[model samples]
Target chain A: MTVDLRRAPAEKAVAWRRSPAGPPRASQKRQTVIRQRQYWGRLFVLPAVVLVSLLIIVPSIQGLYYSFTNWNGRSATWVGLDNYINGIFLSPDFARIALNSVCVVLSVPFGVALSVIVANLLANNLWGRAWFRGIYFLPIALSWVVIGITFAYLLSGRGPINGLLSSVGLGMFSQDWLGGETSALISIILVFNWSYFGINVVLLFTGMTTADASITEAARLDGAHGVKMFFNIVIPQVRRYVELCLILTMAAAITSIFALIYTMTSGGPGVSTTTLEYALYTRSFSLGHFSQGAAFGILLFLISLVFAVVRLRAGVKADDD
Target chain B: MTDRNSTIETDTSNDVPLSATPPRVAPPRSSSAAHRTGGRRVGDRISALFSTGLTRIVLVGLAAGTIAPLVFMVFKSLTKQDGTNAVTFDAWAAVLNGKLPQAGLISLQVSVIAILVILSIATLAAFGFAKLSFTGSQPIMATIIVLMLVPGQTFIITEYFNFSHLGLIGNIPAVGVLYGVTQIPFATFILTNFFRAIPDELVEAAIIDGASYPRVFWSIFLPLARPAMVTVGVLAFIGVWNDLLIALLFLPTPGSRTLSVVMAGAQDTRTFDVSQVMAGSLLSAIPCIIVYVIFQRQIAVGLTAGTGK
Candidate 1:
């Protein structure tokens, strides 16, 4: 970490003066280098700071400002807290959409827990470990659009599931999974799990990879097997990974799009599947209520921020202890 | 398919028993059976066999759930519903001849532009954050972390008007820029760690050798940062390629749609072309898959290195 700036001539002169080396006036050189380092530091950071400010920092502030105003995608006027009051309290979409988001959030822990269990098994070198790992992690690479299209194809009224059921004389069991108010959100949840479980598996696998295997071995030597070993030995070791995964899952699921809903049900069967993002889109772009959408965005942001802050604090405390 | 198989083969061969020098896994029990004559190793073998069999069945079920949608998409994309019971390639043909190319081009444009902007800004920001001391740096980093938690939907309404004011309304480039910026926090956070991992002595030596900080960065830091840069680039590209909401919002102009946007658009025009959308989705995924396959080890290492801690 030393910064030294001695001109070539000075080095040559010092060399020429009999004694080839005696630190070469370290004090004077250190001063020059420190001053030069300050200049370099400023130069290195200027462009990055400017771009970040322009693109992310300023826009974020603008988002905060716009939450209070009734701007209709054009000119803006101050409306105090009217937008927030109307969007959050008066409008019923906020409650409905918030509930939908909660539904999505509630499903994440189950999905993450399942993924971790499966990952622990795979990490243990059980049957078909490599193939199972690949299969478990494949859906993460697929887009939500693809997930929606595929699920809709399977669950649509005249789709293959019904076709199979009718042919098998189980026609009574067939239902329009993606077409009913009761079924739309459930179908989306299933598709969401299938699409995201791969990522969870990968995260869990990564977590398990770092686990101290000697601990597990000791547990196994003590006659622990399967579920017992997982709960008592492996789980504690991956607590941070599990927590981080939960936070990420909650963040992603909460802001999930109407894409699947847009394609499969279009937030229909009585707007039952309209999550916050979907509702925000519907309000702003579809319904021309800009400030309301901004308000919804703010609420979503605040909720996500709360969870992130909680996770961050937990992470810091974990580090401290 | 052959390429994918080869990559899988490579991963398997390279990853066999990493703890090779000293046997990591315990050897199965054998000699203990002599103490219990009749109740023996035979029972353990039988139980192990039974467990492995049951595990295989469970594994198959897991695979079926994971693979079913993809298989369904492939099947639907290949077959067209012609009248009563007939199947045809009309959908696939339409996808290839028209929608595929259009969607592919749009996605490529968006992904490339998005990656370029994101890499440039993110790499610089990473350097700044990793190397330079500054006032309010910790707060700014906290803000970046907060922004990462805030979903992109939160910024959409504000950005929609902002882009409009910037005269970028209906432009795919504007949408690309937005997607790129949304990903910066992740890229910068990741790359900053990568930057910090570089030996400070290397950079100091370069500085002592009369190189400027910029020169040291370009020569020393950038070269050392290749894996991290690639990781960030790949993730950013994937994010942009898969983005539907941003495109739907800002790039509403006809023919300006990315693959995901166009795939959604296809739902309106015709009966859903499962094969076409699958083909498009698979095709959109190819560039990343290729990069991932070629650099699988680097990717695995880099991602694990960046995110694990």
Candidate 2:
């Protein structure tokens, strides 16, 4: 009891020191503590710095150099702007893949909107809530490789999905989902949303379920209820989560859909579903054009780097506040 | 706590927790409040435009929509292609001798090594960022944030080139090291927030008693940060386990094939057997699905940690 009593004053002093930050206000011992924090902090953070630099920093510089070369995974000569020029205008394949990546961005609003609506549904007062959550989030746990196969099986011409449609007299609506040019990109986007929507649903529902109770109650008492209360009141609170979901989903779409596309379509139907990430893979590893692939990778890196900068700036500023 | 861990948490550890930890303790409490919404489909049998049964039916349908593909894949893999969908292990039997299981073993080996590599690197880096205060710390962290923003695609080409140059291609441990390297920034970011949540008094008191920083860290913080470590470790596990492209490029040989690469091969023009495809997909997916089942709640917390709450 006495130990607690004696420690209380020191704790208070520490708290006091924290509330009003200034070197002028700190005692000699407190100053030492701050110095200690700084020394140890630097020691801990540097390995990650060195490691990340090796992994990404050095490689990115090498990638930039490779972009300016005529290298095909072998010896090379300088080929300034040739790759970029081809990537932007001359190469029809590159342009198609670039457009397909935009299709990923266009697919985002559907995902976010559907996730929000379903999250609201799951947040309702109901039995079997946990079961529903488990079911919805199940796909999020599966790898893209697995989701790709599952979709491929279902969308095949003689698959069970078409069988079910035919049994129900709806066979005309079920085409060879992954076999056509026009429908192939749409199918990719749809499956992409299917594979991931559960994650965002759980994410948004977690945010919505955790909104301030008193505020929600206040809104309820003020005759704002149902969809109106959800839109007008609850959404503002969970908007940060919504934004986080957007940034993450957009990033994943840009660089990480290679598995799904590679497995399901192989950028098929004459490159209908080819996104930039897939193009990068085929150009480098498949076609043995490492330099061109490096250029494509650089282009995507710059795009995602922009998002990363915005997020980091916001993160740093938020920390300051 | 164990129930929550079943949810698999590391997927969202990328967000640097600008706001810190204590705020996170309260989120689950509101999940209970979600159970108490006013007359909004209360009594489990009350509703408006449609009866509650209809709502439940719709919900069950939606749930089926999400998980049916996985269930279908599993059953199809275990069933015979004898035209009657009779449950048999023909696909499973064939796949066991095929490349799928071999690639699975490779993935298992790689994921284990990658998890260890990531944990060792991320643990100390996170501790430093969370506990050690130094000049330029903020700027250094900001740089990490920006580096993280650069997608893996940005570096994969050159990384492949460098690895090929070094002849590290098809080497499982090298890919493991790469996995660890890619994950450091995010894991460190999560661990730093978690480490910062430890009260300063304990460390200060230990320091005053003539204890070294490493001693205090190992003795005090490591034990306290166990859950966070598990969370970060499992998150890293998911990342390494789920990857396909880099592993495919780096380990192109048939013998070095990882589970995802083998699954990708299922769709190749040379082989179009649906059962083999499903079987390979299951082999690749089951580990992550099992992890998710075991760590469901922890996964949600880790995932949400960087949402700026």
Candidate 3:
């Protein structure tokens, strides 16, 4: 390649302002306008681009570098693989938290299935549809802290579930909800479903609207009813939406659950509810182990980056299509 | 019976038709009558009735299950859930005194600052993406979409490092800036779709008329994109208002606490007083609920823009 380095493109010569003779020719002005647009366009986007880099990119790189060190947010020493080893294997709760996160995102299908049902129903020919949708999304609109505290109250030892159980003469079934190891994770998952299912309902219901009524009617005419029609016909047709739902749900699970966990169980009942995200919090802030926390953050970034890239491509492709 | 198609029709009719994420459902208008009364025969009607009945059952059940927590919190906050036989507003009153009010103030302050920053930056960025193609626009936009898609947990620790180094953590405005930056991608995404839907001719006319790019953006497109701007603003408001994890990490001391931080504190130290926590949480949720009830459609439109359509 012949390196002919010019500070400006060839268009710059022609794109400059023409003399004020002959009322400034249209073509020259057009090129100049185009050049102006490009300049302003880049300038307009620059602030945000800089902010994103300053906030996300630089910190991310620093986080990676610090992960290999023994930085405790205050001081530092180079420690090779120590933080990663301690975070993953040596630390008791780290592995469990990792497993817990995997389990949470792994359970995306459960939330999806549940929301799919409600969304389909919402999309159905039912009265009070608006009311139902509003109620469904009520939880979503509320802060995660509010929902977490509310559920924590409900699932607390002497809370409403027990109150209901005892009131119904099923007092024997009443036990510590958040206090129990097994129940803690389950409770978190249930709350997770409760909080997020609304977004999926909205998205999928919107998707369901796009389903061809003619095809559905044709299926109905062919004696395809209920479960068979929905499973074979309706569900498969909304592949794009299902994919979008899964992506959003997974991302929400990993990043947004910190509030819920922090308020609900504090990743407690002996680390049963701790996930990688929560571990990042305690490790960095509570434990003052910035390097380990950064390691966890890097791992989290890698996980999110893969999903993010896939989602980005999908979104771009969908837009292109 | 005919309500099925109406939701789809109504959803878009309520929208800006050229919405970046156009909820362009299949035009079911042509076949609505055919599908509805087509099923009027005895067996089909019966099945239809059965399904509608079934749908009602499921919807009612689902709503009950979903709304139970909210109802429970409200009820318990106003009543006595603790063993002491006293019905009182003390829990609500207690939270209202120093903690809840202060937290609410901090939250409002943070969200206000955050919203301004988000809207200003997102609008400008959206204009670049939608109207003017510049060098690296594609990659920059791709970077934005990727950033938006990823879990924010990835770089929060980095934020922590940055904030700690600058001694800026616990500063509400700094938290606001962070919150605002986090939302730039989504807001820009929603706005870009919104801005692109605007006719190119409009921008061209302004440019040909000698309006500068910024002038055209400010005077022509911004006005056109107001509904979208509102939608993006409402969405940003909700995200920042309800944010907990960021506030939890950044605002540690009670002096700097947002509502969520205060509520989380209640959950931590006052585990026995569930009523107080519930009351505090309910108070914190009021602004969010009010905003949501008022702007649910805009929020939905913003969230599903380009994706849902």
Cα error, residue A192 of model 3, in Å, equals 0.7
lDDT of 2 by residue, A114-164 (tens): 888778777774679988888787776788887887887788888888899
Query: lDDT-based ranking, best first?
Result: 3, 2, 1
Q: Second chain TM-score per prediction?
A: 0.78, 0.81, 0.82
What does the TM-score come to for chain B in model 1?
0.78
RMSD of 3: 7.2
Fnat per candidate:
0.43, 0.73, 0.67
User: Candidate 3 — which pairs collide?
Assistant: B21-B306
Model 3 docking grade: acceptable
Candidate numbers sorted by TM-score from highest down = 3, 1, 2
After the best TM-score superposition of candidate 3, give how far the Cα of residue A195 lies from its true spot, in angstroms. 1.3
Q: Among these predicted structures, which one has the highest DockQ?
A: 3
**Stronger candidate by TM-score (2 vs 3):** 3
On the 0 to 100 scale, the lDDT of residue A197 in model 2 is: 88
Q: Say which candidate scores most in lDDT.
A: 3
Residue A160 displacement in candidate 3 (angstroms): 1.7
| Candidate 3 lDDT by residue in tens digits, A210-252 | 6667756654554455676677556755656787789878988
Model 2 bad stretches (over 4 Å): A1-43, A309-321, B1-51, B269-271
Can you tell me the DockQ of model 1?
0.27
How many clashing pairs in candidate 1? Answer: 2
